[model samples]
Target chain A: MKDRVTTPLGAVTLLLLLVAVGLGLSSPLDVNQGSLVRLMFVHVPTAWVSYLAYGGTGLFGLLYLITRKRRWDRLAMASGELGVLFTVATIVGGMLWAKPTWGTYWVWDARLTTTALSLVVYGGYLLIRAMIDDPERRARVSAVVGIVGTLYVPINYMAVEWWRGVHQTQTLKLLGKVRFDAAPIYGWVLLIATAAFTLLYIYLLRVRGIVAARDEAREERELMNDLQGDLNSLTPQGGLRG
Target chain B: MDKYAVYVIVVYVVTLLLLGAYLVWLAQRLRATRNEAGLTEQVRATSTPGNQTSSRQTPGKRG
Candidate 1:
């Protein structure tokens, strides 16, 4: 009954714009990375949101099985789809940054390889859902897959620490101390970008949910029609004659 | 400043373009699907006749 685009979605759009402006002005360009560092404003947020989105899918997948709610399944699927997009964005952005800094577009380093594997796992989840015709069965199997895929997130985070690799150490965290200077402008920018990306993710998930819900409704209608037609066929002929 | 500046800029620009295009595509698809569902619901409501009333009336028949 509510307008899908104008209410929650409008709020998200405004938040994203505010954050984008804050991030743009606050963070100084890295002395070494130069202007390329600005890309981090987008890249890091995408990566973070992708992780959050996928985690949400896993959580909803679990809840759906227990609650037996079709709505939860729909939400899980929508989140998974959005997660894949963000993951793709993260990978492409990382590769772009890598080429300039590491002198190669890709390497089989622990972090990159594990992250790629994570992407493949989620991609397989969608493929498996497509391969099944029954909605209930699809949700059950995909839920299992979603739970298993979550194990890779922690591995992806720790890949740099666990192995010697070409990937530079994480810049955002260090030995119980935040290294980056927390000047007001920089702090405000990061906060804004983070807020914006989070809203963008929510907006995307909502749109996808609406699309999925419509598809389900359409399927239900077709199924009902088919059942009715079958029933009509089975009914006795009007006349008693042969 | 660095030689790879061009590459970074190109990559960022391309990413923005791709994501922008995708969002637009999603919005269009959402509109189309909603429209299709609405039309289908209308058709079903009209074509189904008194089946709805019959179901409510025949609740005690318990097949």
Candidate 2:
């Protein structure tokens, strides 16, 4: 049974996914949205994962600055990359859900607007990394960018409440505050789905971080080889002397 | 099917497709990195004098 899992975290993710599907698809429909409410299971969770991913990027970026660890910086980059992917998922999923509910694909509502900003900000975060050549300099500069770029997260969270937009308010809030306009099973499905998405994030982060580290190592090795080849050509013995 | 079922299905299908594509890409990248790193190690190991490997090919570009 254990071997069925690719990784322990992956196993948990798969299990939670199964539970979420079992409950989410079978749960009673929303009074207002009907079967369309099923989309919430995917939309809400992907949005939440985007939050967690960006938050992880900021946290790891800060840690990289403080500890000066290469792995931390690599993990930060991995998280940012994943954040972009999930953010795109969130936006598209929300837009699809919106069309059925609100009869439109998108609006300039506060939450939606800030979400669009999130795509820009995190997208810029990735773009800046590619423009810098030195890894150390890139890590330092992007660590600062990563940290500051996430300032919009809290604002994004509070947008609906503060600005009163067409977008709905958060389903779950901090400090034991919870709101569910649907059946209890719907809530359960949501909880499981969110957990499943969170676990999936962790699993992907682990795999991506390993790949990122190896890529960085390979890049550095290539750079070293280039430098060595140049030195060999400069020697007095056909290298170094020049 | 309900009137809005198509919308629901579209969202799920698109989301799943995007996620599956990302996972596949990640898996391919991991394989590429492993192969590239292995070649780098092999090159370094054989670079010792009198132990030169015939192939002096540089590692190929990665995604």
- After superposition, the stretches of candidate 2 with alpha carbons farther than 4 Å from their true spots are A1-6, A175-181, A240-242, B49-63
**Interface RMSD (Å), every candidate:** 2.5, 1.2
Cα-based lDDT for every prediction:
0.77, 0.85
lDDT of 2 by residue, A1-242 (tens): 22233477777887887777666666677777899889889989998898888898899999999999999999999999988899999998888888878989999999999999999999999999999989999999999999998787888888888999798877776535566765677788888889888888888888899799888997898799899998898787876645
Give the winner by lDDT: 2
Kindly list the per-residue Cα lDDT of model 1 for residues A84-176, writing each as its tens digit: 888888889888888778889899999889888878988998888889888899889888888778777777877888997998666566447
Query: Candidate 2: which docking quality band?
Result: medium
Best by DockQ: 2
Worst 10 residues of 2 chain B by lDDT: B54-63
Native-to-model Cα distance after best TM-score fit, residue A148 in candidate 2, in Å: 0.9
List chain A TM-scores, every candidate, in order: 0.87, 0.92
